[model samples]
Target: MTLNVLFAARPERWESYEPILKSEFARQGLDVALSTDHPPETVDYIIYAPNGPVQDFTAYTRCKAVMNLWAGVEQIVGNETLTQPLTRMVEEGLTGGMAEWVTGHTLRYHLEMDLDLARKPGDWSQHNPPLARDRPVTILGLGQLGQAAGQMLAGIGFPVTGWSRTQKDIEGITCLSGDEGLIEALKTAQVLVLLLPDTPATTNIINPESLALLPKGAVILNPGRGPLIDDDALLAALDLGQVAHATLDVFRTEPLPEDHPYWHHPKVTVTPHIAAETRPATAARVVAENIRRGEAGEPFLYLVDRDQGY
Candidate 1:
């Protein structure tokens, strides 16, 4: 029996994903009828994006699973109508991209690169940066992306500490969990990276109280969800030198409003959300593999725990 797969993302995405998905399906040895307009009831699986048109999942009675193209599922996880098993993307491309971006920003803080970059032509002041071994870096959220970034940092000689909702046991990382562990993680974090998901427990996890725990003048890098940090608290922390600088890549409002205070804050560096993106070439294989798993009756990989909301 041929499986009907629906490509239910934006129109432009269809142009990029169609040929790759078709080729991937063939490579996976699956007979699939792939289309943007398959009848919802006929769809055996859906390659989905939250911004896509297929919001109403009530009609997709036969959808075995919803394969999300993006890593973060906060946008679609709450939809009451979506009852199918859902899997979040966790491929190499997305993980590698995130690791690279996180490492780059981390190194920038470790070396105080910005001061030199902004130096006037004649202003020659010497500053010596400590070796990576002396820098203590803390990463919040020990999921795939967090683990990858932490491992990369640890490999480069930084003492890496990771905090998650539950205790983790990754080699080479000082793993901590729960409220007391969070305090310990923040205390020595000269460079704190936030990679946690947007959940009720994590929202504003970086408020004034948490910010106060950091070593004074610590640098913060947020490539995770915007809601993870409290904007007012962060701004206050910046003003008081509780935090030396912050490099934010994600925000509650994308294309962060022109009038937002972060735009004019001297200590803030805001990059349009480009930290990690789902690469079509690698992401297609993940989607294909999951569909293959569904057909084979094997448990799907990266299945989202609806209750935990990741």
Candidate 2:
């Protein structure tokens, strides 16, 4: 029997993803009829995006699973109508992109490159940077992206510590978990990276109390969710010189609001949320593989825990 797969995302995304998904389905040896328009009741699976047209999932009674196009699922997890098993996108492209971005920014901070780049003419003051081995980098979150970033940093000799809500034991990383572990992780972070998901428990996790844990003049890099850090607390920290600089990619409001304080703050570097994006080729394989898993009765990969809200 041919499985009906609905591509429920933006029109532009349909054009980009249709052929890749079709090719991937063929490569996986699955008889999938992929389309942008399929009767909700007939859809065996939904390739979903939060901004997509399919909001109410009550009609999609046959949908065995929802394969998300993006890595984050905060927007879709709360939909009361969505009862199907949902899987977040986890592919080589997304992971690689995130790792590379994190590495680039981490290196920038470690090397103190910005000072040289922005130096005034004839102001040649010599400033030498310590090697990566001397830098203690802490990452909040030990998921695929975080782990990959940690591994990359570790490879370059940075002493990397990773903290998650749950314990993880990845090689080359000092993995910490629980409340005590968070405090310890913050204490050691000369440079800190945020990669945790957006959940109630995680929102504003990097507030005043957490900021006070870091050593004076610590650098912060946030490519995770915007709400993870309390903006007010971070601003206060910056004013107090507790945190020397912050490079923020994701934000509570996208385009970061023209009048946002982060934009005017001299200590903050805001990059339009370009840290990572789902690559069509690799993401298609992930979607197709999950569909194949659903068909074969195997457990899905990257399935979201509804209660945890990731």
Candidate 3:
């Protein structure tokens, strides 16, 4: 079938995906027209990026869906002009990168590797760390990224507990959900990883009250949405030893203003939003597959439900 796909992402990204996309389409035996600018009202699917120039989707009357290249869709979801189905990027590249980064840091802290490596030769102090089974990890969100990281930790014998708004069943992980289950999950968590989406309900999810529920020397790792954690409360928790340290990969602001306390904090590790990245080569194929399904009268994969707000 012929499809009028609009590639609304930036000019820079075009070169990366153009060849790969064309090859994928040809393999699927589909006739496709790619356009940098939104076409006349007949646009069937829009390949989107929130930072791109396409804001008004109302004109694209025939558009079946807005397939986002980036996983975080909070930027474009709130637009009133958008009436089309929105699907966030779900690809192996992103999932693998997130799992690797989270697991790397979790193991680093758990093993006390940094302290042992930096110590002077004469002072071989045997400051042993607790066993993996004794250390509990509380993962917020329990979504794709969270679940993947939890499984990696669980494989190494760490007692992993996951907290989400809804209950989930996964092998080797203690999954907790809803308001009541939060406290139970937090109490046993020595390491907390934030992976929740940034909706109104999730804002400041790691406030002082929630932070207090965790073990006193808990380490906080945020590779998820920036606003899910309250900046001030995290620092306060660190001040009182409620939270021993925080490894932050996201922030409320991009470029993370020069004056931010997290930048200077001794107990904080600030990564420039590099926890996970969408690889255009792989992500474009996922986008194309969904579009193919829509064209072939098959159910779309990863279709966003606007009412649930993801």
Best candidate, lDDT-wise? 1
List candidate 2 stretches off by more than 4 Å.
none
Local accuracy of candidate 2 as per-residue lDDT tens digits, 72-114: 9999999999889999999999999999999999999989999
> What lDDT does the true structure give each of the candidates?
0.96, 0.95, 0.88
Among residues 3 or more apart in sequence or in different chains, the pairs in candidate 3 whose N, CA or C atoms overlap within 3 Å are none
- Model 1 agreement with the true structure over 112-224: per-residue lDDT tens digits: 88889989989989999999999999999999999999999999999999999999999989999999999999999999999999999999999999999999999999999
Check candidate 1 and list the clashing pairs: none
Deviating ranges (above 4 Å) for candidate 1: none
Q: Write the per-residue lDDT of candidate 3 for residues 1-310, one digit (tens) a residue.
A: 5688889888898999888888888777779987786464978888899988799887899999899888788888788999988998889899889988989999889998879778997986887888899889989978788889999999998999999898999888999998889999989989999998888889998998999998999999999989988899999999899998899999999989999999999999999999999997788789879878988889888877676566
**Candidate 2, residue 188: how far the Cα is off, in Å:** 0.8
- My TM-score estimates for the predictions, one after another, are 0.99, 0.98, 0.96
Q: In model 2, what is the error at residue 32, expressed in angstroms?
A: 1.8
